[model samples]
Target: MTYVKDQSFKQDSLEISIAEPKDYFALLKPRVMYLVVLTALAGIMTAPGHVHGLIGFVSLLAIAVGAGASGALNMWYDADIDAIMTRTRTRPVPSGRITGDQALAFGLILSFASVFTLGLVANWLAASLLAFTIFFYAVIYTMWLKRWTPQNIVIGGAAGAFPPIVGCAAASGSITWDSVILFTIIFLWTPPHFWALAILKSQDYEEAGVPMMPNAKGLDRTRLEILIYSLLLAPVGVLPWLFGFASPVYGVLSIVSGLGFVALAWRVFQRRTGKPADSAAKGLFAYSILYLFLLFGVLVIETAGALILNRLG
Candidate 1:
């Protein structure tokens, strides 16, 4: 009887000790990873050179791992602030599902592995960009800027924007004007996207001591900045067509979408002075997400169509 009880207790303990795969997956921030992968694919497709199927697959996989690693590290470092913010309190590290040390180790290992593997499979330029992206997000943005300045997202946006450039390098072994335009679009789009959320979550940032735009610069100023960025992003979206990479279909979609984005931002600016301003800000935030997805979706379709044409020819 005693032996059986001890055996049963040990079995229960073992079950409790085992961590689910999903918890590790959560550490990767899968939603953000999806965007990174899609944008990187767009970069690869838009480039003016060819990449082998197997090599491209490996490079994309490596890029994804690196992006996930950066998210993990950001979570690890921001666990304190994340715990305080309602939006992030349930994340793996802050929720006590994973310890900071575990997240840190996971991030570091993934970062090193992804960068090294990318270099082995692709060019050093792609790998170097990946390494810099990881460092920028993990250290520059998460550790220092997020807590220190309102412009954190503005400059740190570069980290997220680098995927297309990295993809271009992986595909062509060099970056070009087209990749730079892709980079510019994302970089400019980030502020308005995030600032809208900030307007909605000023209290969260204040509680977490994060110097988000609304909190640091006042709500009115943040709204103006959001409108400014939206206006800037409008023209950048039309550049791929002018540069001669995208088709007329992409051009039409981009122009219409950019106008819609600016109109939403204008609403956000106008309504920001009142009440919660929840409706306006939330509307912009939601539409901004769809805007990016649609823009990139068009790019993906165009690239696919071009590939089909090339094969047929």
Candidate 2:
């Protein structure tokens, strides 16, 4: 007996809650979009400029809407494979909560609305980038890369990595070293973070006919790549401090967290002796998300602290 904000289409439409905003929000994948919006805001906040509160709110909203649109489109396109993968089988499209056509229409309408609103409220450049991001994730990543090559996540990672840049562009209308650095950090971080999951979920993917790194390359090779990328991610994570953008707090946290990430990779690489080979990979996969969240969280807090210090000064 969930209530609908509006009428919804479902058997026992009474059994389904149409009025609750949560269900529709779930179709938008708000949890995933929250991370996207946070990272994007961090990039915008850390950059050397000021965004007005109203404009900033609209900008974030537009980016968020665009992200949701992308998720809907992704779910729409991947509904078939999603139905097969246990991890994704419960998604709105696959679980009978939302139809693929409904998702497609929802995504397209939101995509256009977000872009048009952003361009009207902010700038065309950012709006255009948002449009491209939605298309990139929905089409390039979900539709093509996910099924074609083991390098799927590697290339597909770019879709997720674009949000920060889009936020930066929304704020400043152009790219900067700082913005590009933020993009670089996320871009480089994506491969290893996802490959960890791929390693563990190789079977899930192979069964679904998706070519992830672990399936394309051997497990040992994938582990090596994860270690390598993690090493790169550690130093890149600290570029804010390297470029004098933040205080030493960021540098210290980045170094410590980065080291921890590398250590986790090492553990997975060497001590992978017990349980299914998937266990070690799964451990790395889960930890990698924590690592990135912590890494970015530190940067966001560090920047906010600096803003307060400057305000006091």
Q: Provide C-alpha RMSD values for all models, in order.
A: 3.6, 5.6
lDDT string for model 1 (1-313, tens) is 3345344354544423244679888899999899899889889989887788899989999999999999999999999999999999999888888888888999999999999999999999999999999999999999889999999999999999999999999989999999999999999999999999998899999998899999998998998999999999999999999899998888999999999999999988888556647898999999988988887888978898889898999
Work out the TM-score per prediction: 0.94, 0.90
User: Which segments of model 1 are wrong by more than 4 Å?
Assistant: 1-18, 273-276
Winning model by TM-score: 1
Over 4 Å off, model 2: 1-20, 276-279
Q: Whole-model lDDT, candidate 2?
A: 0.82
Computed on alpha carbons, the lDDT of every model, listed in order, comes to: 0.91, 0.82
Candidate 1, TM-score vs. the true structure?
0.94
Instruction: Tell me the TM-score of model 2.
Output: 0.90
Model 2 per-residue lDDT tens digits across residues 1-313: 9776875666564444232455467778887797888878876786567878689789989999999999988888998998988888988778877777778888999999999998988799999999999989999888887888877777878878887788888888876788778788888888888887777677888888887777777778888888888888889989878998767887898888888888888877775555755676677778777877876787778787778899899
